[model samples]
Target: MRDHGIAHIVETILDAPENMTAVNEIKERAWQAGFKAGYNECLTHVNPLFKSGFTDERSGFHGIDIEAVYAAAVDAYNNLSISAIEDIEKCLEAEDYVDRLRLLFDRPGEEDEAAGDAKNDAGTSGTKVD
Candidate 1:
Protein backbone atom coordinates (compact mmCIF):
# COMPACT_ATOMS: atom_id res chain seq x y z
CA MET A 1 0.00 0.00 0.00
CA ARG A 2 1.13 3.55 -0.72
CA ASP A 3 1.05 6.44 1.69
CA HIS A 4 -1.79 8.88 1.09
CA GLY A 5 -0.68 12.44 0.41
CA ILE A 6 -2.79 14.01 3.16
CA ALA A 7 -0.98 12.88 6.26
CA HIS A 8 0.10 16.24 7.63
CA ILE A 9 -3.08 18.08 6.69
CA VAL A 10 -5.22 15.37 8.22
CA GLU A 11 -3.18 15.55 11.38
CA THR A 12 -3.63 19.30 11.72
CA ILE A 13 -7.30 19.31 10.80
CA LEU A 14 -8.06 16.59 13.36
CA ASP A 15 -6.51 18.66 16.15
CA ALA A 16 -8.73 21.73 15.73
CA PRO A 17 -12.18 20.36 14.99
CA GLU A 18 -14.00 23.29 16.64
CA ASN A 19 -12.20 26.30 15.18
CA MET A 20 -11.78 26.04 11.44
CA THR A 21 -11.34 29.70 10.69
CA ALA A 22 -7.61 29.15 10.79
CA VAL A 23 -7.80 25.87 8.93
CA ASN A 24 -6.32 27.06 5.68
CA GLU A 25 -3.50 28.85 7.40
CA ILE A 26 -2.76 25.78 9.46
CA LYS A 27 -2.74 23.61 6.33
CA GLU A 28 -0.44 26.03 4.55
CA ARG A 29 2.00 25.99 7.42
CA ALA A 30 1.92 22.21 7.49
CA TRP A 31 2.45 21.93 3.74
CA GLN A 32 5.29 24.44 3.58
CA ALA A 33 7.01 22.77 6.49
CA GLY A 34 6.49 19.35 4.93
CA PHE A 35 7.73 20.57 1.58
CA LYS A 36 10.93 21.96 3.07
CA ALA A 37 11.43 18.60 4.66
CA GLY A 38 11.12 17.02 1.15
CA TYR A 39 7.49 15.94 1.33
CA ASN A 40 6.18 18.32 -1.32
CA GLU A 41 5.41 15.45 -3.63
CA CYS A 42 3.32 13.92 -0.92
CA LEU A 43 1.48 17.19 -0.31
CA THR A 44 0.63 17.47 -3.98
CA HIS A 45 -1.40 14.31 -3.77
CA VAL A 46 -3.44 15.63 -0.83
CA ASN A 47 -3.97 19.17 -2.14
CA PRO A 48 -6.99 18.31 -4.20
CA LEU A 49 -8.82 16.51 -1.43
CA PHE A 50 -9.16 19.66 0.64
CA LYS A 51 -9.91 22.03 -2.25
CA SER A 52 -13.63 21.20 -2.55
CA GLY A 53 -14.59 22.49 0.89
CA PHE A 54 -15.13 19.07 2.38
CA THR A 55 -14.19 20.54 5.73
CA ASP A 56 -16.60 23.46 5.61
CA GLU A 57 -18.87 21.47 7.90
CA ARG A 58 -17.97 20.60 11.46
CA SER A 59 -18.62 16.92 10.73
CA GLY A 60 -15.93 17.35 8.07
CA PHE A 61 -18.63 16.91 5.44
CA HIS A 62 -20.51 13.71 4.67
CA GLY A 63 -18.56 10.46 4.73
CA ILE A 64 -15.22 12.14 5.38
CA ASP A 65 -13.40 9.99 7.88
CA ILE A 66 -10.25 11.63 9.18
CA GLU A 67 -9.44 8.93 11.68
CA ALA A 68 -9.11 6.27 8.98
CA VAL A 69 -7.21 8.55 6.64
CA TYR A 70 -4.78 9.55 9.36
CA ALA A 71 -4.14 5.94 10.27
CA ALA A 72 -3.40 4.99 6.67
CA ALA A 73 -1.17 8.02 6.23
CA VAL A 74 0.87 7.28 9.33
CA ASP A 75 1.23 3.62 8.52
CA ALA A 76 2.42 4.52 5.08
CA TYR A 77 4.74 7.17 6.50
CA ASN A 78 6.37 4.67 8.80
CA ASN A 79 7.08 2.27 5.94
CA LEU A 80 8.97 4.89 3.96
CA SER A 81 12.74 5.03 4.04
CA ILE A 82 14.61 6.42 7.01
CA SER A 83 15.06 9.78 5.29
CA ALA A 84 11.41 9.99 4.37
CA ILE A 85 10.47 9.14 7.91
CA GLU A 86 12.68 11.95 9.11
CA ASP A 87 11.01 14.39 6.75
CA ILE A 88 7.57 13.24 7.83
CA GLU A 89 8.62 13.54 11.45
CA LYS A 90 9.61 17.13 10.78
CA CYS A 91 6.15 17.84 9.40
CA LEU A 92 4.54 16.01 12.29
CA GLU A 93 6.66 18.03 14.68
CA ALA A 94 5.50 21.19 12.92
CA GLU A 95 1.91 20.04 13.45
CA ASP A 96 2.65 19.65 17.13
CA TYR A 97 4.10 23.14 17.20
CA VAL A 98 1.04 24.66 15.57
CA ASP A 99 -1.28 22.76 17.92
CA ARG A 100 0.56 24.15 20.90
CA LEU A 101 0.21 27.61 19.41
CA ARG A 102 -3.54 27.15 19.14
CA LEU A 103 -3.80 26.01 22.75
CA LEU A 104 -1.68 28.92 23.92
CA PHE A 105 -3.80 31.38 21.98
CA ASP A 106 -7.02 29.95 23.37
CA ARG A 107 -5.94 30.20 26.97
CA PRO A 108 -4.44 33.67 26.60
CA GLY A 109 -3.21 34.86 30.02
CA GLU A 110 -4.61 32.01 32.07
CA GLU A 111 -3.08 28.58 32.66
CA ASP A 112 -5.13 25.47 33.22
CA GLU A 113 -4.14 22.97 35.90
CA ALA A 114 -4.88 20.09 33.55
CA ALA A 115 -2.15 21.41 31.32
CA GLY A 116 0.30 20.80 34.12
CA ASP A 117 -1.11 17.35 34.75
CA ALA A 118 -0.87 16.40 31.10
CA LYS A 119 2.72 17.52 31.03
CA ASN A 120 3.54 15.60 34.18
CA ASP A 121 1.80 12.38 33.12
CA ALA A 122 4.30 9.56 33.50
CA GLY A 123 2.39 7.47 30.99
CA THR A 124 4.51 9.16 28.33
CA SER A 125 1.69 11.44 27.11
CA GLY A 126 1.83 9.35 23.98
CA THR A 127 0.76 10.81 20.66
CA LYS A 128 -2.06 8.70 19.27
CA VAL A 129 -3.92 10.12 16.30
CA ASP A 130 -6.38 7.26 16.02
Candidate 2:
Protein backbone atom coordinates (compact mmCIF):
# COMPACT_ATOMS: atom_id res chain seq x y z
CA MET A 1 0.00 0.00 0.00
CA ARG A 2 1.01 3.64 -0.54
CA ASP A 3 2.44 5.55 2.43
CA HIS A 4 -0.43 8.01 2.57
CA GLY A 5 -2.96 5.17 2.62
CA ILE A 6 -1.22 3.62 5.64
CA ALA A 7 -1.20 7.03 7.27
CA HIS A 8 -4.93 7.33 6.66
CA ILE A 9 -5.47 4.00 8.39
CA VAL A 10 -3.46 5.20 11.37
CA GLU A 11 -5.52 8.37 11.51
CA THR A 12 -8.77 6.45 11.34
CA ILE A 13 -7.77 4.06 14.13
CA LEU A 14 -6.66 6.98 16.26
CA ASP A 15 -10.15 8.47 15.91
CA ALA A 16 -12.09 5.24 16.50
CA PRO A 17 -14.02 5.01 19.77
CA GLU A 18 -13.67 1.24 20.11
CA ASN A 19 -9.95 1.38 19.50
CA MET A 20 -9.58 4.09 22.13
CA THR A 21 -11.51 2.05 24.67
CA ALA A 22 -9.37 -1.04 24.11
CA VAL A 23 -6.17 0.96 24.44
CA ASN A 24 -7.38 2.49 27.68
CA GLU A 25 -8.15 -0.97 29.04
CA ILE A 26 -4.61 -2.11 28.26
CA LYS A 27 -3.16 0.86 30.09
CA GLU A 28 -5.30 0.12 33.11
CA ARG A 29 -4.28 -3.52 33.12
CA ALA A 30 -0.61 -2.62 32.83
CA TRP A 31 -0.97 -0.27 35.79
CA GLN A 32 -2.62 -2.93 37.87
CA ALA A 33 0.04 -5.50 37.02
CA GLY A 34 3.08 -3.28 37.83
CA PHE A 35 4.29 -3.65 34.27
CA LYS A 36 4.71 0.07 33.67
CA ALA A 37 7.76 0.46 35.91
CA GLY A 38 9.13 -2.93 34.90
CA TYR A 39 8.90 -1.91 31.27
CA ASN A 40 10.92 1.26 31.89
CA GLU A 41 13.65 -0.61 33.71
CA CYS A 42 13.71 -3.37 31.09
CA LEU A 43 14.24 -0.77 28.35
CA THR A 44 17.31 0.60 30.08
CA HIS A 45 18.88 -2.85 30.39
CA VAL A 46 18.06 -4.21 26.95
CA ASN A 47 18.10 -1.20 24.60
CA PRO A 48 21.87 -0.92 24.37
CA LEU A 49 22.18 -4.62 23.57
CA PHE A 50 19.37 -4.41 21.03
CA LYS A 51 20.90 -1.39 19.31
CA SER A 52 24.30 -3.00 19.06
CA GLY A 53 22.79 -6.19 17.72
CA PHE A 54 20.84 -4.20 15.14
CA THR A 55 23.97 -2.30 14.08
CA ASP A 56 25.97 -5.46 13.37
CA GLU A 57 23.42 -8.34 13.23
CA ARG A 58 26.18 -10.89 12.48
CA SER A 59 28.39 -10.94 15.59
CA GLY A 60 26.81 -8.51 18.07
CA PHE A 61 23.87 -10.76 18.88
CA HIS A 62 25.92 -13.73 20.07
CA GLY A 63 25.09 -13.76 23.77
CA ILE A 64 21.74 -11.99 24.12
CA ASP A 65 19.35 -14.23 26.04
CA ILE A 66 16.03 -15.13 24.36
CA GLU A 67 14.16 -14.75 27.66
CA ALA A 68 15.41 -11.17 28.04
CA VAL A 69 14.03 -10.33 24.62
CA TYR A 70 10.64 -11.76 25.54
CA ALA A 71 10.61 -9.79 28.79
CA ALA A 72 11.43 -6.61 26.88
CA ALA A 73 8.52 -7.19 24.54
CA VAL A 74 6.02 -7.81 27.32
CA ASP A 75 7.19 -4.77 29.27
CA ALA A 76 7.31 -2.56 26.22
CA TYR A 77 3.65 -3.19 25.46
CA ASN A 78 2.74 -0.55 28.01
CA ASN A 79 4.92 2.01 26.27
CA LEU A 80 3.07 1.80 22.97
CA SER A 81 0.48 4.47 22.22
CA ILE A 82 -3.05 3.28 22.91
CA SER A 83 -4.10 3.80 19.30
CA ALA A 84 -1.13 1.80 18.11
CA ILE A 85 -1.88 -1.09 20.45
CA GLU A 86 -5.50 -0.92 19.32
CA ASP A 87 -4.45 -2.13 15.87
CA ILE A 88 -4.21 -5.70 17.13
CA GLU A 89 -7.31 -5.56 19.34
CA LYS A 90 -9.43 -4.03 16.61
CA CYS A 91 -8.32 -6.60 14.06
CA LEU A 92 -9.30 -9.38 16.47
CA GLU A 93 -12.75 -7.82 16.88
CA ALA A 94 -13.34 -7.50 13.12
CA GLU A 95 -15.74 -9.91 11.40
CA ASP A 96 -13.21 -10.48 8.63
CA TYR A 97 -9.93 -9.11 7.32
CA VAL A 98 -11.34 -7.00 4.48
CA ASP A 99 -14.09 -5.48 6.59
CA ARG A 100 -11.48 -4.55 9.20
CA LEU A 101 -9.42 -2.77 6.58
CA ARG A 102 -12.46 -1.02 5.06
CA LEU A 103 -13.36 0.46 8.44
CA LEU A 104 -10.23 2.62 8.30
CA PHE A 105 -11.34 4.51 5.17
CA ASP A 106 -14.93 5.13 6.22
CA ARG A 107 -14.33 8.77 7.15
CA PRO A 108 -16.86 10.75 9.12
CA GLY A 109 -15.29 13.92 7.67
CA GLU A 110 -16.23 13.15 4.05
CA GLU A 111 -18.10 15.84 2.09
CA ASP A 112 -21.83 15.37 1.55
CA GLU A 113 -23.20 14.13 -1.80
CA ALA A 114 -25.11 17.40 -2.46
CA ALA A 115 -21.90 19.50 -2.36
CA GLY A 116 -20.12 17.15 -4.76
CA ASP A 117 -23.16 17.06 -7.06
CA ALA A 118 -23.28 20.89 -7.16
CA LYS A 119 -19.64 21.03 -8.32
CA ASN A 120 -20.46 18.59 -11.08
CA ASP A 121 -23.39 20.78 -12.17
CA ALA A 122 -21.42 24.07 -12.21
CA GLY A 123 -21.14 24.34 -16.04
CA THR A 124 -24.79 23.46 -16.72
CA SER A 125 -27.43 25.99 -17.76
CA GLY A 126 -31.17 25.83 -17.01
CA THR A 127 -33.19 23.81 -19.55
CA LYS A 128 -35.72 25.67 -21.75
CA VAL A 129 -39.37 24.50 -21.79
CA ASP A 130 -41.71 24.44 -24.83
Q: Please report the candidate that would top TM-score against the real structure.
A: 2
Q: Cα RMSD for candidate 2?
A: 15.1
lDDT by residue for model 1 (1-130), tens? 0022245345543454333423444454555444343433444555686664223233322354444544555555444344333444664565354334334233334443332244325322223343
Residue pairs clashing, model 1: none
Candidate 2 accuracy as TM-score: 0.27
Candidate 1 vs. true structure, TM-score: 0.20
Local distance difference test values of all predictions, in order: 0.41, 0.49
**Please, what are the lDDT tens digits per residue for candidate 2 over residues 57-80?**
333333545445545555655454
- Candidate 2 clashes between residue pairs 3 or more apart in a chain or in different chains: none
User: Which regions of candidate 2 deviate over 4 angstroms?
Assistant: 1-3, 35-130
